[model samples]
Target chain A: MTVSIVVVSHSENIADGAAELAAQMAPDVLVLTAGGTADGRIGTSLEKVLAALDHAAGGDGTVILTDLGSAVMTAESALEFAEDPAGVLLADAPLVEGLVAASVAAQGGADVQAVKRAAEAVRGPSQNSGPPPQREVSEGSVTGQGPDFTGDFELINQAGMHARPAAKIAGGLSALDAEVTVNGVDGASMTALMTLAAGKGSVLHVEARGVDAERAVNYVGGLVQAGFGEP
Target chain B: MVLDVNWAVKWLTLCAQAMAEHRVELIELDRAIGDSDHGENMDRGFQAVLDKLAEAPPATPGAALKLAAMTLMSKVGGAAGPLYGTAFLRAAGTMGDAAEIDPAGWAAAVSAARDGIVARGKAEPGDKTMVDAWAPAADAAKAAADTGGPEVLSVLVAAAEAAEAGAVATDPLVARKGRASYLGERSAGHRDPGAASSALILRAAVGAAA
Candidate 1:
């Protein structure tokens, strides 16, 4: 079974809509929504969140995405009262983007922690002001000290690097033991990959490091060559 | 007056009464810097607490507080729901199966409640949040409890007074947490609805004993 997801939002529409959007990308994963109060108010309810957590307890694990400050508090309060709090985690990421990334990761069979990371990774460098300087990779560095694997593949899909393709590559790569980058952006970040705006026929330069480096490079290459299974 | 299950029940009943009486005032306070639902949420939450208490009366003070915690968290539809719910839950945890609370036990329970609010909201004292009232009240209860006497009324009064003062103190401070923080400097010159409600709840404890 895959990891489950819970979306908490002040507005019922937001929670339901977010879960619905995420489900489209990861139909196999369970995405639950605990939004609004029991009396049909525009705020979150701990009871609803706790009930959602109870339902999600049957899965491998549960990750929560909250919309606002009080929604976060309500989710935490639910965890405090949950029967199995340890198996559930709260991801500090934007609701819609994080839910989508987390659902994709869970669909790809990533474990709980990896799923959380995939969700958080959506907040890439641009969002994090003054990110730590990256380790420089000189041009034409092909030695053992350089990247374990690297490849360039031209996008052939009519949709190019869209949400689905980015999600697919990011989701699959998140489960691997590698640090991969596509066009200088974090490869495991769907938002980062999509930021490239790499259209049809635009080449994608991939770099990888770690034990799954070769697998990571081949994974992206295969998806690109297949046009991400799209027209 | 013994701080027992009866006292707990009375305290919660008074809290519900106070919420109903001060609902509009709280709504106006919240409207200035928050979403303007604190009064309605707290009133509904405590009403639910009353219903639960009547349906299944708890045997101990802790059990009563625990029931309130669950009820408030479920019925209150705003940030106050979780914040106050967690405070009551942690306080209940401290009380455990005990039927009555001594002065020291009361102090510890209040402290536990404050810590839970801090842990859940991640707010510190002077953040223009409920923690402002809770922190000082915890401190006052602890001090009063340590006075080497069994004056339970004094301890309750001390907490209530300190909490009231804390609520007043929020009137001049710009909010550093919660939705009010969005207003930045504009949040000052207004009382924090959470702090105001916290004071009212603590004051109700005194009324229960009196």
Candidate 2:
């Protein structure tokens, strides 16, 4: 079963709208909302959050994304009182962006931990200054340290490296056990990929290292070569 | 006097009365630095607690506190909901299923409640938040209980007085946490609504004990 997502926000409209937007990118993923108090006021409710956690318990796992301060506290309180807290995780990421990234990863069949990583990876350059350090290959390598797999592919679609294509590449790669980078930004991050702004005919430099490194490179190559199945 | 379920019920009822009595004053205090909903939220939350207590009369002091915790977290539509909810819940955890709480036990519960608020809110004593009141109140309760006396009323009175003084001490400090922090220098010269409400809650405990 796919991992479910819960959105916690002080404003009911914000939670509902964020879930709605994430649902568009990952239609198969279940995104629930627990926002506002029971009396329809503008604040989080532990009961509402606990109810959402209970509803999401049937899935493989649940990831919680919250907005503002008290929302996070309410989510934490719900987890403390949850029947199965082990299956629920809280992502310390922005609500909208993190929710979308998490939904996309869940749609790609990522497990609970991977889905959380997908959401947290959305942190902008300000939070994460640079690309992750390249992993050193243990096996006999001519170079002292290098990526296990590397590839370069040109963007062919008219839209180039847009939201959908980036989401596809990032979403698919997040499920893989690999550290990947396209150009200079994190490949598993949708927001990072979008920042590249690589237009049609621009080449994407890919580097990967891990058990699924080769598979990650090929996955990106396949998506780019086929124009992400878009015009 | 034994701190039991009856005392807990009386404490919460007095808390509701206090909130209602000082609602407008709390709103004014919050308006100076915060979102101005502290009074309304606390009033609504305690009223809900009162209703829950009526519907299901708790068997023990801990049970009553647990009921109040859940109700506050559900009905209070603000940061205070989670903050006070966590405090009460943690305090209840310390009480366990015991029918009566000794002076030392009550003091430990107060300390646990304060710790919970600090952990949940991540605020320090001088942050101009509820911790300002709770921290000193907890300390006073522990000190009073440490005297090895069976006088529970003395411990409650000490905690309540310390909380009241701590809340007043927040008047001139610049807020370092919560919505008031956004105001920067403008937040000074104003009492923190959270601290005020915290004092009121502690004072109600003393009133119940009396």
Candidate 3:
């Protein structure tokens, strides 16, 4: 079973909307919402958060994403009061993007820690701008310490490295044993991959290591070649 | 006299009374620098605590505090909910299963509660938040408890008085945290609503002991 997700927000609509948006990308993942007071006011409630945590418990694990200050405090208070805080984690990231990333990771069967990482990764370098993350290997013999496997694929789809494409690549890579980097960014990180902004016809330099190295390369190659089933 | 479960219950009951008595004043203070919900939230939270206490009265002081912590966290519906909840929860942890609290226990409990507030709110003494009141109160309680022939009542009074003074001291300071901080220099000359509520709560502890 995949890890469950809880969205905490001061506005009920915000929590429900964020959960709804995430569920679209991760149909099988459990994304619960704990927003607003029990009286339906605009504030976080510890009881509601506790109830959501209780529901999310006993799954593979649970990752919580919160919006604003009091929501974070309420989530922390719930964690403190929880019967077992072992598998529960609170991600310090923007609520909507973090929830979507976490939900996608969970749907791909990532562990709780990985799910938290995915959520937090949303806050990394802006996806569509900025210089790529510095790679340990230099350009030439970058292959000397090179990835176990490498492949170059052209983006076939009209809309290139957008959120959906990035999510697909990231979701698939997270389940693999390989550590992959796409065009200098962490391959399993959706936001990082989207940062590549490799639009249509752009060549994506894919590299991978670990036991699933070849499979990871083939996975990205297949997705890119297929245009991620998009136009 | 020993501060026992009965004392805890009475303290909470008096807290509810204090909240009711000072609700409008807190609301006015918050209106100057916050969302104006402090009094309403505190009153609602303590009333819920009273209801919970009636539903299942606790046998130990710690148990009573834990109950209060949960209720306030659940019902207060604001930052104060978790802030005060953590404070009470940590204090309860210090009390453990003991039926009564001595001067030292009171000192420890107050300090733990203050630390919990700091951890949860990430506020410092001069932040013009509730920490302004709690920090001095904790120090004063500890100092009173440290003196030879320390009396529990003396420790409680010291905390209450120090907290009251701390609350008063916030009136001229610029807020560095919470909603009041948003106002920048304008926040000065207004008493921090949280500090005021905290002072009231601490004063109620003295009333309960008396």
Q: Highest DockQ among the candidates is held by which one?
A: 1
TM-score of every model versus the real structure: 0.94, 0.95, 0.92
Query: For residues B1-210, what per-residue lDDT tens digits would candidate 2 score against the true structure?
Result: 889999999999999999999999999999999889999999999999999999999999999999999899888978999899999999999999999998898899999999999999999999999999999999999999998589898999889999999999999999999999999999999999999999999999988988
What is each candidate's DockQ, to 2 decimals?
A: 0.84, 0.81, 0.79
Return the clash pairs for model 1, or none.
none
Compared with the true structure, what per-residue lDDT tens digits does model 1 show for residues A43-89?
99887898889889977999999998999999988887789988899
Query: Which candidate do you rate higher for lDDT, 2 or 3?
Result: 2
Candidate order by TM-score, decreasing, is: 2, 1, 3
After best superposition, candidate 1 residue B9: deviation in angstroms? 0.5
lDDT of 2: 0.91
lDDT of 1 at B25: 100
What is the lDDT for B28 in model 2? 99
Q: Which stretches of candidate 1 lie over 4 Å from their true place?
A: A125-144
Clash count per candidate: 0, 0, 2
The whole-model C-alpha lDDT of candidate 1 against the native structure comes to: 0.92
The alpha-carbon deviation from the true structure for residue B154 of candidate 3, after best TM-score superposition, in angstroms, is 1.9
Least accurate 10 contiguous residues by lDDT in model 1 chain B: B147-156
Ranking by DockQ: 1, 2, 3
Can you write out model 3's per-residue Cα lDDT over A1-231, one digit (the tens) per residue? 899999999899999999999989999999989989999988889989989999999999999999988788899999887988999999888998899888888888788888888888888856424564333443333344768899999999999999999999998887777679899898988888887888999999998977778999999999999999999
